[model samples]
Target: MNVAENEIKSVMDKYRKFAVYGLSPDPTKPSHYVPLYMRDHGWEMVGTYPKPHEANGFTIYKSLTEIPKEYRKFIDVFRASEKIPEVVDEAIALGGVEVLWLQLGIHHAAAEAKAEKAGIKVVSNRCLIIEHKKWF
Candidate 1:
């Protein structure tokens, strides 16, 4: 299901700090640049990388649980569609995740439902940069 534009705007407005799940160390990838774009736009971002590596000076945690609780309020995911369930599981397990945002081209209905059921707002198949530019 598509998230409404107003809900998207509200999600963006309510959560300024978020964790980037599946963040890449490569600067060329959206997993890298999207978080950078958000950071540049004044969003406080930390990230989860498979390995210990830095992305444009942002703190890269090895997993969601590694991210401090305060920064776990929102998660901007960049993993493949198939990987979303695992991400959602991790987010739910981690708790305190107010929103789960799957970036453009990423969507998983089951996972979205799971997240929403767990009291996290889900925004799927949308680009945070694009929405931010349009709404704010």
Candidate 2:
């Protein structure tokens, strides 16, 4: 299972927990289904948002700072491409965030650079669910 050029998947291979940013509470939302699908493939997924609340039977975090220390390995983002820079910053602040995965159709050069510069691997414009499926 080769990750992209920038994303090596080392942290992904070593970690079981995943923090999903921009996760939608609504089941009909694409952000909701994509991570949900990845969860079905044996990946532990945590839903995150910009609000401190609850959604889909899970607690919503206002930012990556809200994530717990133990589960900070992979940070998957589903927001607009333009917002990725902020996500990258959040990932760096959280520490131990290995993979900075932007959801399908989302990409930003600056964000990728930020993550890479901070030693976090980058995977933009890719779907974790789809990648898992293809790998298996």
Candidate 3:
């Protein structure tokens, strides 16, 4: 399999739950809609927002550490590219992160490398909805 395919397979085989970092309350935003879509399609989703809030019935946490350990295994990030290193650091610190998924238009090479070095699979600049549709 190609690298992307392999990564997707690995993530699919391992994690049923995911945490969205920077999940927005706005329905029009992909950050809001993508996780909702995933939830509807049977992927358990929790989120980390800047503040404690609810977005479309999903609980939003204030930090990665606040998310349950099982949900922390797959983190799909929606923060800006420059914000990724901090997110990476948080994921590394929190530990047990199996995959770090950077949403479409977000990419940080150094952060991705750091995540990979820490043994976390990194997928960047990809839409989770698009990929899920394509793969399954």
| Candidate of highest TM-score | 1
For each candidate, the alpha-carbon lDDT, in order, equals 0.88, 0.72, 0.86
Query: Considering summed lDDT, which 10 consecutive residues are worst modelled in model 3?
Result: 1-10
Pull out the clashing pairs in model 2. none
User: Which runs in model 2 stand beyond 4 Å of their true positions?
Assistant: 1-12, 52-54
| Candidate 1 local lDDT, residue 26 | 91
Residue 51 in candidate 2, Cα distance off native in Å: 3.2
Candidate 2 accuracy as TM-score: 0.84
Off by over 4 Å in 1: none
lDDT string for model 1 (7-62, tens) is 78888888889899888999999999998898889899999988988668999888
Question: How well is each residue in 75-105 modelled by candidate 2, as lDDT tens digits?
Answer: 7788888777777787787688877777789
Candidate 3, pairs of clashing residues: none
Which is superior by TM-score, 2 or 3? 3
Error of 2 at 75 (Å): 0.5
Which candidate order results from sorting by TM-score in descending order?
A: 1, 3, 2
What's the TM-score of each model vs. the native?
0.95, 0.84, 0.93
Write the number of the candidate with greater lDDT, choosing between 2 and 3.
3
